[model samples]
Target: MERALKRYWPIFILPTLLAFLIGFIVPFVQGLYLSFCQFTTVNNAKWVGLSNYIKVFKDTTFTDAMKFTIAFTVVSVILINVLGFAIALALTRKLAGTNIFRTVFFMPNLIGGIVLGYIWQILINCVLSIVGEPLLALNTQAGYWGMIILTCWQQIGYMMIIYIAGLQNIPDDLIEAAQIDGASSWTTLWRIKLPMVMPSITICMFLSLTNGFKLFDQNLALTAGEPYHSTEMLAYNIYNTFYARAGAQWKGIGQAKAVIFCIIVVAISMIQLKATRSKEVQQ
Candidate 1:
């Protein structure tokens, strides 16, 4: 069986490799090239060198979006992981109706991002109407918090599930041993459970970080970066630059922003993974 599998591995891998080259690698290379050229379409690309990047750096809207996205990612990553881990801890404690609770909590994650955005927008607007605020679109602070709340609500449950799996995988003997050693519950959790769950933490943090960075549909549907574009995030900013602007130069600038976005995300994700993985203990 091992011999058969090894012999046929390349045959099975070839299609996927080809598809990846066609779907991702090709477009990625092309996008990198287009970032240095001005063009309305791929066929008409004209080399403009680093002027696109220069424009990207000079654009105040892009700078604001970059700052906004970083802030949002930082806040969301902290909230989602802390809340998700707390909920996972609670649900794993043999509480009554835990299955039902899990299902209820996780159901929000199944909803589409666009749908969740619209739903929250209506709910938030209804509440704000009582106080005579215009709407989420008109209040930058409110829109910022609304996006944070919506992201946390949608993501926490999914992260909780991952934490639960990590919690469950912990050996009963180790926990019992800690108890036998007169360790308090807090001590046991800090010394044993958390270290054991570091793998889950890594995964959750990576997901949350990347999701926060790449978020667009929710940003679009929720606030649409209203109130003079104060709430626009990097992804939405790039998108608007690509399609909403009048001239061909904007496309190259947008592509440059995308490349920068990709680099930031990848670099941050790699650093996070390395930091978390170092803390993880072998079972």
Candidate 2:
């Protein structure tokens, strides 16, 4: 049986592998090549070396988008993880209607990003209208905070579920031992629960970080990089460069920006994994 299973494993995996190659690797290679070429279409691509990359660096909108994206990612990652963990802790306690609360909190995550964006847009605009301030589309600061709030609201519940799973896995005996040793609640959390939950923390942080960086549909539907493109994020910037702008050169530049964006996300995710995994305590 073992021999048959091992022999058939590749057969079982071949279809998915072929699909991955066709769906991802092929297009990725094509995109990498196109990043160095100027063309309106793949068939007409003409290699221009690193000129597209150079143009990407020189684009002020790209730089601004990069800065804004980094700031937003940092804020959203922190808020989502912290708030999610906090809620998980609360919900795990001896509280009434905990399941109901969990369901309510998690429902937002089920909504599509574009739908969430439009819904939040109307909600935010209504609030600003009541306050007699400029709408989200016209106010850069408002747009930034609105995105932050929207991201946190959508992600916190998902993270909470992960945290709850992690927290529940912590042995009751270990917690009792901590309390028996006169450890305060805060001490138990800081020293025991946190370390035990490090794996979940790593997962949640990676998701939040990457989602923050790759955000697009929400950014588009929410602010549309309005008020002179001050709120444009890196993903939106790449999209604008590729589709919104005219000319073949812009396409190549957008491709280069996308390649750079991919590299940035991979590098940052690697760094985050390394940092978080180091602190993870093996159970």
Candidate 3:
């Protein structure tokens, strides 16, 4: 069986490899090249060297977007993980209708991002109208908090499912032993459950971090970076730079921003994984 599997490995892998190269690798390499050149299209690219990178740094809007995105990611990551884990702990207990509750909580995540954004926009606007702020786009703070709330609502359920799985995988004897040893519920959670769930934490954190960074559709539909682009995120900023601006130079600058964005996300994700994985206990 092993020999037969080995013989057919290339046959199984070749199509996926070819698809990946064609869909991702080739375009990525081309994008990197285009970042160094000014062009409206691939055929007419003119080499412009480091000027695009320089322009990216000099753009105040891009810097603002970076700051906004980082702030949002940090807040959203904390809220989603903590709330999700707490909900997971609750649901894993011998609660009534646990499956129904899980299904309802997770339903928000299944909704499209654009649809969620519009739904929240109208809901928030209505609430704010009672206090005289009729539109979310007009208030920068409202837009910021609205995005955070919307993200947390959508993501917590998914993270909760991961945490629930982790909790279930933990040996029942360990928890029972802790209780027999006179450990309080808090002590058992902190010293037993949380440590055992570090692997789930790592996975949930990585997903939340990346999703927060890459948020675009919600940002577009919710506030559209209104009130002078105060709520613009890095992804939306790059999109606007590429499509909203006229002239070919903006495309090169946009590509450079994208490359920088990719590097930042990759570096942060690697660091987060290393940090979290170190604390994970082997089952």
Candidate 4:
């Protein structure tokens, strides 16, 4: 059976491999090439060399978006993971209605990002209006915090579920041994549960980090980079550069921005994965 499975593995994998190459790899390679060319369409690309990349750096909007995105991602990742882990810890206890609570928490994640954004926008605006405060789009600080709240509300539940799974998978015997050894709850958690749950921590951190960086639809629906693009994130900034503007040069510049965006996300995600995975326990 093992020999037959091994021999047929390539056959099973071939279709998916071909689809990946056609769907992702081919387009990615073409995009990397087009980033160096000026073209309104793929068929009419004219080599422009490093001009697009140079323009990308010169664009202050792009720089502001990069800064805003980095700040948002950092805050959102920390809040989502910490809150999710805390909620997971609470729910894992022999609490009443645990399943119901989990379902309630996770339901927000099932909502579309655009829908969540609009819903939060309305809700926040209503509250602000009641208090005579400026609307989300009119206030830079409000817009920033609005995105953070929207991201955390949508993501914390998903991270909580992962944390719950990790907590549940801890060996009962190991926990019992810690208690039997006169270990305090905090010590047991820090020494045993944390190390044991490092795998989930790694997965949750990776997802949160990437999601924060790649965020677009929510940004579009929520603030739309209002108050002079001060709240714009990198993804939304690229979208504006790509589709919201005109001309072949803009297209080339957008492509270049996309390539740079891809590199930033890939680099940060790799660093986060490496950092988290290093702390993960073997079990």
Instruction: Give the poorly placed runs of model 2, Cα more than 4 Å off.
Output: none
Task: Residues 120-199, candidate 3: write the lDDT tens digits.
Answer: 99999999998888478789999999999999999999999999999999999999999999999999999999999999
Over 1-283, each residue of candidate 4 has an lDDT whose tens digit, in order, gives: 9999999999999999999999999999999999999999999999999999999999999999999999999999999999999999999998999999999999999999999999999998998899999998798998999999999999999999999999999999999999999999999999999999999999999999999999999999999999899999999999999898988899999999999999999999999889988998886
lDDT of 1: 0.96
Which numbered prediction scores highest in lDDT against the true structure?
Answer: 2
Order the candidates by lDDT, highest first: 2, 1, 3, 4
- Each prediction's whole-model lDDT (CA): 0.96, 0.97, 0.96, 0.95
Better of 2 and 4 by lDDT: 2
Q: In candidate 2, what residue range of length 10 has the lowest lDDT sum? A: 222-231
Model 2 lDDT on a 0 to 1 scale: 0.97
In model 4, where is the ten-residue run with the lowest total lDDT?
Answer: 274-283
Over 4 Å off, model 4: 1-3
- How many residue pairs collide in each prediction? 0, 0, 0, 0
TM-score winner between candidates 3 and 4: 3
Q: Model 1, stretches more than 4 Å misplaced?
A: none
The true-structure Cα RMSD of candidate 4 reads: 1.0
Higher-lDDT candidate among 2 and 3?
Answer: 2
> Between which residue pairs do clashes occur in model 1?
none
| C-alpha-based local distance difference test score of model 4 | 0.95
